[model samples]
Target: MARWRIWRPRSRAVPFLSLLLLAPLVFTGLKAVNKIGLSSERNYSRGHVTFVTVFTTYNSDPAEASKLPSNVVTVGKHSYSKVGRSMAILNTFIGFIQVSMPRSNVIILTDPNSKLTHGSAVILPIEGNYSRGNLMLQRIRSYIAFLEQRLEELETVEDINHLIFTDSDIAVVTDLGHIFEMYPHCHLALTFRNNKGQPLNSGFVAVRGTRDGIFKAIEFFKEVLEAYHLKYMEASRMLGDQLALAWVVKSYLPSAFSKFSKHEAFTVYNWTPPEGAGQFHGMPLDVK
Candidate 1:
């Protein structure tokens, strides 16, 4: 089980609270623009990036979807009909990726029963169940299993440089092959949201394919899994993966993960708009 301890200052209680109040401001200023190591001496090539996402097809009817095995149902809080819409969106996502990065690898982890096809993308079937009640933990477990399988294959495969795990609906506007080269030291990259409830968004995660990078990612996921199981706090279970990830970052490995901002070369944004509110913000034209 994952365990954490908080240290409280006995000598200066008021000062600690004051620092806590000011910590956010300090953190914001420090992380607003991180430009260290931007210009590296080594010239790296455009490496291959493998993009992976979890996708499962379901009937448009809720009743029919419910009849399917619990393991095969869509993992999120969306309705069966909405999940059907997501299937369509994922097809478009795959198409954009193929057009943008023709040489990149796109893999989908879906249920074994899914007959849906994605063009030029490798489909791998997942094992075990994903309960709606524990959606975040179950999703993390599935991703962990997938990473483990890939780690074994990485021993002989040298072509893949980075492994990017994204939500099924995420679209690739351009080739992301430069991310790994830009942030060579980034073993794991996590995107932060403005919301306090769940600050760390797990929808987009990138991990280096090197031996050390994969091991660090697995360790991080294992920590989150253990924290979820141990019920680290009420919010950890209530808010799901994001809260659990926040807790892990707070208690341990604070500097282990790279937190990217929109000012950087590439950053993933939370592009969730209201239903039927089609206001979309495409990638910045200046992004290279």
Candidate 2:
């Protein structure tokens, strides 16, 4: 019973369109997809930031992960890793930043009773109750915003300047302190595609959490959600968040839910996946 609104493209080639997607400005369980907030001023000192905000959502509980699994959880072979996923990312992402942003705040959205060997990990719960969003892509669409908005609920958003949002699997070999400087302009920064020209990897994305930056991210997932209502798209598409994310950013239709023209409103990072293919471009990124 979602509401419908008409979105007419400025171009004449695109006729009329109405999407039956009603994104609530306020969500209950996990914060709603469109309820973005902007403070009048930053909470922390901007220049030469000593503390950085970093968070990642991890639902390792078998019951939770089974509900919605990412490409990393499903095929499990995307990243160049052996013996499943290693703990290298935790050390690299948080450890490497100590050189510049020493007091980095690392929050992981995981199950309630999870244990951690890393003394620095701050544990938060990632609820698996995604309604009918049991599919992986649906999980990605629902949770990406949850991760962003949860920060707002904690009241710690304004206290931090740049949010270095990254996936738990990404292994950082070099110091990426400079990438945060793009917050003023890029809003969100991440690798655009892989050498094979795949879609944007949802694994790692840096959102600026400003008036427009966080708004774009939460709204971006709202658009990806339009695919869930399509009778043609399969549940398997949900296996990877990137495919759904790509479609949400580029899709154009009177019945579709994309907001901007192409991807003009994004900042592509320099890092690309070690390997991948573009066979799924313009379509859902899935294994079929």
TM-score of 2: 0.50
Cα lDDT tens digits for candidate 2, 236-275: 4443355555555346433333332232322223333323
Give the true-structure RMSD of model 2.
Answer: 14.3
On TM-score, the candidate that comes out on top is 1
Which parts of model 2 are misplaced by more than 4 Å?
1-89, 99-101, 113-117, 129-157, 174-177, 180-183, 195-197, 228-239, 252-288
lDDT of 2: 0.41
Clashing pairs in 2: 17-254, 137-238
Listed in order, each prediction's TM-score against the native is 0.66, 0.50
What lDDT does each candidate get?
0.57, 0.41
Q: At residue 123, what lDDT does model 2 achieve?
A: 55
